[model samples]
Target: MIITAVLPALSKEASIGNIVLSEIAEYKDDKQISHPYNEVKGAVLNLHQFNGHNIGVIIPAYNEENLIGETINGIPEYVKRIYVIDDCSTDSTPEIVKRLTDPRIVSVRHEKNQGVGAAIISGYKLALEDNIDIAVVMAGDNQMDPKQLPKLLEPIVEGRADFTKGNRIIRGYWKGMSKWRLSGNFLLTWLNKIASGYWNISDPQNGYVAISVSSLRKFNLDSLYGGFAFENDMMIKSNILGIRMMNVPIPARYGKEKSKIRYNRFIIHTSWFLLISFLYRISNKYLFRFHPIGIFYFTGFILIIFGIVLLLFWPVLILGLVSFTFGIALEMKEINKSQLRGL
Candidate 1:
């Protein structure tokens, strides 16, 4: 509402485009390609006005020497610094970072190719040392637009949310995304939300995010998995701690950079990760950490026992089949569907 007038200069295309008959509430249709340019402007303004906090950008690159420069140059001047960590890439990424002329840019090199998760953790540590109040993760592949950066960070900056993430599947980018990937993200996202207990979230696999200094300080960084399942694992742990997670929408840009992940394998690996992370979060939050329920393992043990009993002989036995049906129905109500079968 107010953002449209305040951000006239920010995006003539988005503003004028929204006024077009086709562009109004383009987000409502699942096939409209547009970014909420005015929304991004409002978010950037909110970030500046909230608490006077400083900002930092963390870009984790594997072999993205081609597009990283433009991605870096596109960030607004208000952002304090950019940390470009070369995750032991085989390409010329390291050399490109060294040649960059921006004074605010800092580069880190890893001896071996650590996965994206490890690189992000290292960047978080670096930002903590630099005294940055908030840290935002950007991909080495320039798929995410920097104009939407502020929206991802505003919640944490305003002290209204502990952690914030981008939800491309729900955002204006939905139209730009493929049906298969969209389906995969939805299934995994729905599973993660129930398993982790953050019911209000969407787009569980998106990597773009902003985290507060306090949340980062309180997190057990050593416990997070450093590979592809890192973001899901982080949210699982955060949910256990009762940290608020808010998902902001961003424009999806799909281009020449090949997705390192295979879709089928993504589902299997992330499903296992969600189960493991769920148990860990429950154990750590309830048993080892605190007994909010006044019993160390009441809820966890009950759920596990019920699951085991139903799985024991449900296939062949009639009584066991009945128990299994009732048990699954109860759990379906509690956790909802296992995975969203369709996008």
Candidate 2:
């Protein structure tokens, strides 16, 4: 005989802010309940003080049934709206979100599974329609700390930056990350710095971010990259548009959530995307603007190639390297001047 059941049955536990915790176990041969809810920290901010800003949080979820409820419940009361973009989750993710009684929750289900980036774009569009003054992004897996959201908002709230993002590398905050993941993040950070031209920003991969809706209006949202490279692409676009970006030091959180990314494929694809984006940024910001830096970059590339082909012309290679370095230094100086310092 074969049998299937949700071991221990579906149970709901009431928590602070009337958040419901639905503990449902998957049916298996072992009939074991393995899903564990990581205890999310309470909000540290006085919600009333932030009521003036129409803040909206965009949560992009796919197959995140285990912690979706907790993630939603963890959002601070200061946020005026919660846009949960359900990217066609096969599990009970959609149902779980629907069950939440929070009036602030606006569940938007996709007809088919799109990438997380597409999901976030959908939420951004909705936030715009609602005229949200600020938009923040947090993963649906509960990996982001809700309590630290205030930190990300501080710079923007103070009119210091148009874009603010979490940086896990500062002050040993990235200790929670595994060695392999940390190494991969470091590699991507270097590539993204070159691609985005935000030399001052680190940890470009951290998705915990906040941006003013005004900045979002400047972007052609439909043209943005709709994949895991979304964050990196956003940074590149911001730098091109001269957006003021600030980095807030936030700690990394790892719990029962499993990473959906396949790093091998992700690195290859994102690296290529960054390279192309680098060229696009250079063309738009320097060449289109008739900036002399473009000449240095183009000349350096041609000279370096010819110098290598003509092995006797070693002096040409040195000159090309100097030209390229000078162009990069000048670009960095310009970007640094526009970037706002984090509080």
Candidate 1 stretches with Cα past 4 Å from truth are 1-51, 287-343
Q: Estimate the TM-score of every prediction.
A: 0.72, 0.83
- Strongest candidate by lDDT: 2
Candidate 2, which segments miss by more than 4 Å at Cα? 1-51, 305-314, 340-343
Listed per candidate, the RMSD to the true structure in angstroms reads: 14.5, 10.4
C-alpha local distance difference test of each model: 0.66, 0.79
> In candidate 2, which residue pairs clash?
none
Q: After superposition, how far is residue 140 of candidate 2 from its true place, in Å?
A: 0.4
How big is the RMSD of model 1? 14.5
Q: Which ten residues in a row have the lowest lDDT in candidate 1?
A: 1-10
